[model samples]
Target chain A: MDEFELIKKITPSSLSHREVEIGIGDDAAVYESKAGYEEIVCVDTMVDGVHFLSSHSSPGDIGYKALAVNISDIAAMGGYPKFYLVSLAIPSGWNESAIETMYEEMNKLAKLYKMDLIGGDTVSTNGPLVITVTVIGEIEKGKVCLRSHAQPGDVVFVTGELGSSSAGLALLLEKISTKDEGLAQYLIERHKRPKPQIEAGLICSHYERVALNDISDGLANELNEIAVASRVSIDIYQNMIPKHAELHKLHTEWEKFVLFGGEDFELVGTISSQDWERFAQECADHQVSVTQIGQVSQESDIKVFLLSGQNRVPLEKKGYQHFK
Target chain B: MDEFELIKKITPSSLSHREVEIGIGDDAAVYESKAGYEEIVCVDTMVDGVHFLSSHSSPGDIGYKALAVNISDIAAMGGYPKFYLVSLAIPSGWNESAIETMYEEMNKLAKLYKMDLIGGDTVSTNGPLVITVTVIGEIEKGKVCLRSHAQPGDVVFVTGELGSSSAGLALLLEKISTKDEGLAQYLIERHKRPKPQIEAGLICSHYERVALNDISDGLANELNEIAVASRVSIDIYQNMIPKHAELHKLHTEWEKFVLFGGEDFELVGTISSQDWERFAQECADHQVSVTQIGQVSQESDIKVFLLSGQNRVPLEKKGYQHFK
Candidate 1:
């Protein structure tokens, strides 16, 4: 399909919002910010073979995951996603039906997040398929969370279990067959559609002296980022990490996945030691389990320890880094 | 270079603005909008071998053009460019120094436009090089321009010359050895660095009845877009198109380049008949020449007539379409 035809076929006739002055048909999308709120913006790109393989991911899943990653960025900052612009670079060989399915899935996710799909460009590419999404969000003034706000004595907490997505990816890559179909499906789905911890971030943002960020580049890397940005150190106990039971049963070194595997999209944050109890109670009310995994320190070194009967053994591994 | 190290090297240490609450090295960038102003957002992508070939275009040119195209979108809406996020997908074999040069060129453009280089993603791609830029701008309430605001009897005008970039691309691809060194460099530069018509757009936006859009596609295509969106027809004299003099001298059928060529990033706008003289005077004062090219008509069909001895011949061709 041509650019205009594809846009006309996919563009929604109605994406009603009070702040939207102009929508998809304009040169640029225009919207007003509500009073007393600041805007938070984030962008992410997903490539065909590098980010996902079509053999493993459906068009729907690919579209959903592309938008989901940006949603995770906004969720990491404790903001409400308001609008997004998507630029698709489609290769010539791609089918129009698959393109339609992709937009359908993208629209479904936008509706779920209450976000309007604004304006963007769709161009033909000579290489692999690439989708880039720019998400615009809003948060109350001074309420947006930051990675550099972790205090020296803050208690580091992580929402949800870690390493499941990485474990799921392993299962997909190894082509492992399991008798437990349910377990296999669950793990694969974890890799396919990881949920962004928006509620947990929102709850954490309300508390004083809180630092928040999502675990997109693995747990250790995110913690190190928080440590480096906040100018503090972090110490975590290996036993404190919440790993999936199925993952542990399958792999002996599941902790490696938990610590170094990325794309979990789970929120790892730091709250002041004095406010930990109150934050935990609020998190419980929100149905988000909070686990204390580490503590912020005055020294600027990130250290992970395995607690033996009497002594602590240092477990050294940095988080996953792209282009390494 | 690793992603973090590259980001660290490229990111500006100090990008302080009153509206920018948080800048780079964050989960999401945050900024506050000025009261009574709305936000305008646009995104565009450039892919290797599709948008440009590295053999012909330098890394700096590719980076500058990538950001410049998005700037043109903001300029089309008459908005003040404030910030942009860039996502780079670098293939495995690319040089690190070239990547650094790309970022440096991008930074130079951002500085020139008074925009901040905010947070974005850098991932390794197994395919070709890709760069996606998302820009955010601000305009006063109800001051943003739209393509659908054209009215019947409005005068259609375009800023600067048309088809130079397309003509430039033709020369670059053919490797035509021209002894006129100045002419060759001028056309090549036109393709490499398109200046967004920000000042002209801002001046035109002050008028009460204005409809504006950038001519990224050819004049014929953009006029057709305005016609379709505003539900009005447009008619122009074939001789009125502002083709580059050198191009006209080089190709006997140079009108085709001016009519159907893309990538000319000039502004094509409509102003009511009564406001035409005033707009023209203001444009002249700003050192921008405005040429009256066409008029919006009551009928909903676009037509360009070449006056041949008082006999008008119709020009057939719907302009360039990506898939076609």
Candidate 2:
């Protein structure tokens, strides 16, 4: 089928929100801006063989993860995702049925967030498939959680456990083997479908002077970003890092995965100690476990350190680096 | 260099607009919405081999065209271009200096329209280079010109000439030869840099009940879209269609280029006869030549026809279609 025909087949007939003035068929999509709210815009691209392997990931998983990563950026800004535009560069070998299933999977996640698929472009590529998603979100004025807002004496907290995604990726790649079939399946699912911590981000927005960053580039790299942006040093207790019980039981070197591996769509941020108590309590009510693993320091070196027992060492910002 | 360092090198340190609260360094960019205006969003992707040849086009031309096409979409909707996010999947062979030149060229066009460089992604790809640009624009409430607004007795209009870009591409690709060196250079420049008719679109926004579409696909394809969307018939005099003076002198299949060739980036739409006089005058004042080429009919069947001499024929919707 042609690009127009494919678009017609996948375009949603009705939008869930009344704010959308124009949808897929127009030259551009129009949406009404809410009063007292600012818009957050982010665009992310995932390439086959770079972000995902066609042999390893199902079309659904590829589509789902592509949108999920973009949504996580919105979540990190403590915004409500309202609309998204997806541009796909499909390879010649991809079938119409596979493309339809990809859009179907993406739409399932969009429904959960009440996001309308507004506009995009679909072009044929001579190389690998590329998917680019641009999400438009909204947040109350002055409620945005910026990474540069962290202050000394603030407690750094992370939502959910780290290293699970990386471990799952390793399992998928067969870099490590586990006899526990259930554990392997669970980790694989985690790698394929990561949950963005939007609720936790909303909680951070409620509190004052909180700095937030999403953990897409491992705990060390994310914390280093927060430190550099906020111009403050951070010290984290190595023993306090959270890990899944099944992951902890593995004999593998899980510390490297937790500290240096990437693609864990969890929120890592800092709030004042006083605010952390209430923030942690609020997150608990949502069935999300918030763990305090570090504290911001008055040092101006913009460094992150691991407090392991009686010694402190620099935490290297090591993770996935494209074009390195 | 890694992704973060590359971003730091290219990210504009100062944004031109005060509305941009967060710029390139954040997980997502935040901008305040203007009161009494709605948001218009559009995205377009261009692949290396499919959209433009790497050997034939410079890095600057590729970047500038990628952004210009997306801005044209905003112009078609009668919106003021504001911010744009660019996501580039760079091939491994591309050097850092080439990438920097690309951004520099894109920024030059962004400055012309007062658009801010917002958030985006840059990653290494094992495939061909891909560039996806999402532009966010704004229009006064209720001023959006949709393709469905055409009515009977309306006059169809187009800004600038058609087919120049396609002719230019032909010259660049050596598919056609011309004796006029100056004409060849002009066509080549036109192909590399097609201007978006934002001023003409703004003029259309001031009038009531106008239907607008950009001529990215050939004039025939674009007018067909308007007719299909508005459920009306459009009849145009073949002699009234505009063409560049140099292109008119070509002995090749220039008629086919004007009717079915793509990538003109001109604005085509319909305005009420009463509104046309004032709209044309205002566009003339802005140094834009607006030509009335056709008239909308009351026919219930959606179709487009060309009036050539004494005979009339259906205008076939033939233009660029991926995966054809």
Q: Top model by lDDT, which number?
A: 2
Residue range B1-324, candidate 1, lDDT tens digits: 577689889888777466899888898899999999999999998888878888888999999999998999998988888898999989888888998998889889888767898888887787889999999988999998888889989998999998888777777887344667788788879988988888888887798868888888787777777776787767776778787777877577677778877788899989999999999999998898789987877765555444434666554436654223
| Per-residue lDDT of candidate 2, residues A1-324 (tens digit) | 478788898899888889889999989999899999999999999998888888999999999999999899999998888898999999989998899889999999999999889989988898999999999999999999999999999999998988888888888888887999999998888889999888888888888788999888899999999998999999999889898887866646888878876888999999998888888889999898899998998888889999998999999888754213
CA lDDT, candidate 1, residue A3: 72
Per-residue lDDT for B170 in model 1?
A: 73
Return the lDDT, model 2, position A134. 93
Model 1, range A117-183, lDDT digits (tens) per residue? Answer: 8987787787889999898999899898888889778898999999888777878887444667788
Residue by residue across B113-220, what tens digits does model 2's lDDT show? 999889889887888999999999999999999999999999999998888888888888787889999889888888888888898889989998889999898999
TM-score of chain A of each: 0.93, 0.97
Model 2, residue A88: C-alpha shift (Å): 0.6
Model 1 lDDT on a 0 to 1 scale? 0.83
DockQ, cand. 1: 0.81
lDDT of 2 at B266: 92
True contacts kept of each: 0.77, 0.91
Checking candidate 2 for backbone clashes, the offending pairs are: none
